[model samples]
Target: MTNNKKRQRVPHHPTSTLYSADTSRSESSLKLCRLTSNSSFNDNSTADVILRLYVDSSSPFVWDSTAEDEVQIYLHSDLLHRSKYFAALLSDRWQNPVSNINGINSDNDKKFIRLNFDVSSPTPSSISDHMTVLQLLYTDDFSSVINSVTVALDLLPVALKLLFEDCVKACVKFIEAVPWTEEEEKRVIEIIPLIREEQSRELLSRLYAPDDSCEEMLNGLIMSAIHNHPNTASVKAFVAKLLREFASRESARRVLERAFEESLKVVKESLEEYSSPDFRGDTCETEAIQRLNLHTAMTNGRHLVWLVERMIELRVADSAVKEWIEQAEFTVNLQRTFRDDAWRNIVPGLPSVVMRCTCKLANGVAGGTILATRQVRMKLVKDWLPVLIVCKDNVSPLVPSQKALYLDLEETFLRIISTLPMSDAQELLQQCLSFSTKNLEDCPHLIRAFNTWFRRATQPSLTGDHC
Candidate 1:
């Protein structure tokens, strides 16, 4: 086809001018400029091919009319043949006889090809992209041109369409080596399918991830934040926020549960060893190892407290509550260790650290952050209450925070106690007498517990009261 041949106009802007200058100036600007610095490209006198590009207003590729809708460029068939798309067009089968019409004689010396920007696909920068790729065919240094991901993305689709191997390779190489913004990553994904499979391999790797990869990564972060990181406070806080904002609550629950179990295991084993050392014959070595065990237990107890807090915050503490309730042996070992004078000098914060785990879990159950069943609630307080009493009795000269923790926990235990059967409450409440102070007003939680119990105990039976 030729530029002068009659064709259907674009529907959206049928009469849109290629250029808006007056007729005299528009005629001169029709030949926009030569596109290449190559000596052969600059000399149109010997050029045998004319390339015409025009946008159809109805075409999806057309965007706002910031540039001219049509353009004509002078070209040499040899350099234009670098693109496989143009090489096919310039071959013998496509050539047609020159014809005369409108009393204008055809320029038999030059071959004419009209390239249309209209296509099934759409892109706002299609015209500029094609123009740039065509300009690149005559140049060797592609790095200077395809410098950024945006520029590479713009030129890549056009290069692939033209089957221009060099430009395609250049675009892909630049993209592979550079980092992308979030938006640029989206663009790279969009263009991946249009390129050859081998060409797209590196880009695919950048975006590819195994199934459940997100959960795996979150699990690692949670473990590192809780166990491996030296800066525990800030990292743990950040990880806690991540768990809260994670899309899958069940996955976060699973990750937190795994971490909680691991930390609990370490704390349990350490306390167990400290309470009943598997003595070697050397007394001094055994004592040193026992001190190390207490320190390990205390350190892991702090980690357990953090993990419990996160589980409660996410409402995924059901399993943790059950597990904590079932640790009757662990609690026993902890009580035995706390009763000794040895741990006071080795790990002064051990009692408070251990009780914080119990306190947070109990508070969660009491406050409804974690919805434990009646049985789980009962066993939780039953197993850990003795540990609390032991710490209160044995760890003296309590810091303000430790005293506050014990007070808060005593109240939480009392609150949980009120939820059980009177028989069960009666059994548990009697253990809470140690919570009372010389001044009864100071132990309101204790006072309220007994008051509520007596109030329920004295109520007339429903079966007999109905008459």
Candidate 2:
């Protein structure tokens, strides 16, 4: 049986309105009162404050008989004073006595406070949120009320507006401890600027990263996927997809190039040690160490092929193409290693693995996936063709798959040679005689290459066509 005839209307403050106007008639029938029976919040006889919550007139919440635009609740000044805003407002009004507070009864001692909100700005949930925070003022166990990110986000701004430090800290702690949805994260970002730097440090740390930290992380992931992970195949595929979808192509390029260079270095050093004249002896220790070196080279050679495919897929293999072309010393060591009979018994797959690395790069160049220059195209074939010839000569009679690998590489090399100058093509094509098979048709790619070379060689010069 609260009396509504004593309530007063108020002038609008920009953030929250506070004013008073006389209203002699009761509007209790039109007003909603959300008065809870909890002793801490609803001791009406002892309560000194009546809070009237309302939406701004311009707000879109349709007010009708069933849904009222405002609600009323009785509160204690001592509990409301826990908020600095209320403490200041109550102290000022008590000392200054401005006509009468919004809903205060002039004939009695009770105070009235009106809080109006634009439902569209903060949110339609704002009224509920403010009421929730005011209820929390009477309780010490904030954890029970502030249980979720949505609850925290809803009440945090209200708490901050009321200058309620404890409730603000509670909301912030809840938000910081939980994971946020992307929409929730955007809300957090929007709220960040409103919070003090010291208070928002942990939240900010989650969103901010140093410039090169991402590149370093990508580099580490690449290495770990290729070298350290026990489940290398699936992990490498996963890492490859990450590189493909990474936002910065340059960063992806730099990370892949670094990994490619490192793998190439290991392969080169392993083969150099294996082919070194010093390790060529048949002694048990030397042969055992040689076997280890060859195995290391073969394993890393597979890694190198994987990296090359990723780089080409990303169109970042230009550097790898150049690096492969410049591997003269490595190729020489490879040829020497293949010429030896020891590796045949120890790692029969080593030659195929090494030549596969060469073939992938050459095919990328030939297919124009990697736009290598004429000199790159020439030296690429010049440097690696001998290794291919040596592998064919020294390895077991090729399995069908291995023979197809060699023939495909031979055709790819000839295609690249066709792009080079006549004399360069002449030297590289002569080496392809080893590519011949008993059935001439089996080697048509080689014949096509030679015929194309001869047609170009015999064509009358465009400059000398006058006669």
Candidate 3:
């Protein structure tokens, strides 16, 4: 019994071998030892350092209960020295070399140095809560490095407070290496202000910025910025840069057009109601009315015109731009409200914008060829001539500039018709005549052009045999 008790007191285990001053280990051998070891203080051998880890019931790492309120684990001083926290504290404690100090309890029976740590339920609950940090600290199991990112993020502050640089780096590398979900990105952004490391925040920002894979996220971030910080110069610059990029992408253009259409709806509704006799009030009722100056902006035509010009400047495909313009429901809306005395005149340059897009369509190159296809030219003429004719008739009391534009349009129409085969030209002219008669309008210029062309076309001199 006496020999067994003595054996228990002076443990002969791997932990004892690790801290044995008599044992000599090379740096590489020590590294290998650390890499292979799973237990914190291997073998429970003659422990020179005792760590009394007082933990809440939530702790995931198990410890022996010494008393009702105390839990303890025996460790080697050499292993504890690996941590900067313990290294600094032990350095101070060694300078004094006192067995007992006030506020620090000691066990005379154990004959070992003691350090106390308090981990509560609220902070640093367990290895479960900070798996990355604890894994980095205790084991070679780095498999959790990527999968345990939230654990790493949570442990960063704790690691920093503990002065654990290795753990800090592990947390940062975990964050940097992994891709983030949208919610994780939002959480990171929320916590950015709290992080003291400038480099970490920069890494986070680089990660958060939208790439091609996250265009929707980019749009959402921009809208959030506009809503939350409308006057921020950096945000405005970002928006401008993003707008330039989006101008060339059909999907992005469609999104912008949809947003603009909705905004237009809000503004127009408010303006239409603003003129009503029953609408007399100074109080703001709807958000759209309160925030959007629809009457002023729409009346001056600056907002919509700027959007159209941007599309033009970006050289968006002419057909797509024209289709978007049509989808805006602008002509239909304007027709309904234009006759209202309340409407602030017409949206200026509306016709000019359409005409410019038409010209671009008339000049596009075909696939595998440098010249514009004849089919495209015919389609352009067929689509636009009718619209111009209607605009000339319905857009009331045409100004001199608009009338001159109509005349030019007539000239272009005749020139286009002249390029077609006689049979096709005759058919197109007959169709034009049918349209003129059905609409009950005396378009004398159009009728005269069509009649002269038809008469010349049937003269039989054009289709003579060439022997």
Candidate 4:
């Protein structure tokens, strides 16, 4: 779009009589006296119509929180045409305009129309100053509307309510420009329900969205949206897209790691109290569950699974896997208290499935007579073995209750070897054995399980070896 189009899109608010005054006069001279309980506008000689704005007197706009303290402004009735809201109020034939008129006071021969503005704000600071709202109402000065994020947010609904499209656009523009920190994102998400227009909602959603250049920013937006709207399927699907993008970008690997790190921190804090010196585990279960809010835990567990699966696929680094395993250890204790499907699937089922698939692939290569097949198998196993080993070593201690998890992984390992020709199976077993022996002495159960599978599988291979 050209500058003229941009200029046309954002309505300009020029100087007007209500706010702007002679440079020689001080600003205080232009300041309208804040109305008090007994104050009434004498519209007789000065203006054609006295438009009274009755906000929550408690709102700073009225100086005091009382019904009689309505802010009164004098303006020509034709000015209502500038605002669609006011125009409709006066022109709507079916609506009872007379009912809206509280009373008419004829002062100094001018007609005064009294109407309640009813601005909603529970506290004084919650809404914008009455004078600023009035200035925007009558004049075209919108520069102050976008001055601050808080002001912009507060003004948006008012702008929409008063049919101030220009101010609404300006607010949207301001929101787009400002950096939406996590807290601000949450605030924006919460207020989404209050915005009535589809255009405005889409604009706000776009503001929350990150551009393609920053994967982490997009990740953060998705996380925030998912956090706020956990049940929304669209938000969850967006998360999957973000994960795929994160996997492809080598630079985003650290960003992905950091996001998981922050999520794990929440998990850590929730479980930390249980490990405290003073607390006995018996009574702490209920308190712990409350602190580890079920919704958040489930979301994080799903996130954990998503991150781990991507990390494994991208082959970024084993450290992320290790960190996740460490976090999963705390979750093990929860199995005794809560047997959630998502938690179980992530904690053990997924990892077990991964190993099973890897084992099957290695087994296929072993039975292949072709040299290329065997070479491909060797490279695949060489790259995958350490990751499998780390998971096996770390998770075994973490989830001891799930004994079958280790058994399945061990059995899968043996199945791969058994399918291999005797020599190939033996060599693969030796590679695993060496790694386990060096790094995983403490995981005796896994070693023993591996040894048992190896022995059982190897015996048959040995007997048929030369046959």
Q: Per-residue lDDT tens digits of candidate 2, residues 1-467?
A: 66442233332221221111211111211122223333345345555566666656555543432223455666666677789988877776655432345543532554444333333333655455666777677666777667778778987998888899889999999999999999999999999998889999999999888899899999999889978999998999899889899999999999889988998999999999987888877799997898899888888888888998898899999999899888889988988888878878777888888778788888888888999888888888988899999999888788988898898899899989899989988988898899998999888998999899989989879876765
Q: Give the TM-score of candidate 3.
A: 0.38
List per-candidate RMSD values in Å: 6.2, 7.2, 16.6, 20.1
lDDT of 1: 0.76
lDDT of 4 at 35: 33
lDDT of 1 by residue, 84-170 (tens): 987776575344423211222234554444344442237655555665676676666676567678888877888898899999999
The reply for model 1, stretches above 4 Å from the true place, is: 1-39, 93-105, 108-121, 280-282, 462-467
Q: How well is each residue in 62-175 modelled by candidate 4, as lDDT tens digits?
A: 443322233455543455555677677667422332333656456555445544466555434322343345445444446534466666666666676778666677676787
Between which residue pairs do clashes occur in model 3? none
lDDT of 3 by residue, 326-423 (tens): 43344434443344333234344445434433433333322211233455445556656556655655666767776666665565555566666676
Which stretches of model 3 miss by more than 4 angstroms? 1-46, 55-71, 95-108, 121-124, 127-135, 138-147, 190-202, 207-387, 390-467
Q: Kindly give the stretch of ten consecutive residues in candidate 3 with the minimal lDDT sum.
A: 20-29
**Lowest-scoring 10 consecutive residues by lDDT in candidate 4?**
3-12
Per-model C-alpha lDDT, please? 0.76, 0.77, 0.49, 0.49
Question: What TM-score, computed on C-alpha atoms, does each candidate reach?
Answer: 0.85, 0.85, 0.38, 0.38
Report the error of model 3 at residue 221, Å. 16
Q: Once model 4 is optimally superposed onto the true structure by TM-score, how far is the C-alpha of residue 92 displaced, in angstroms?
A: 8.5
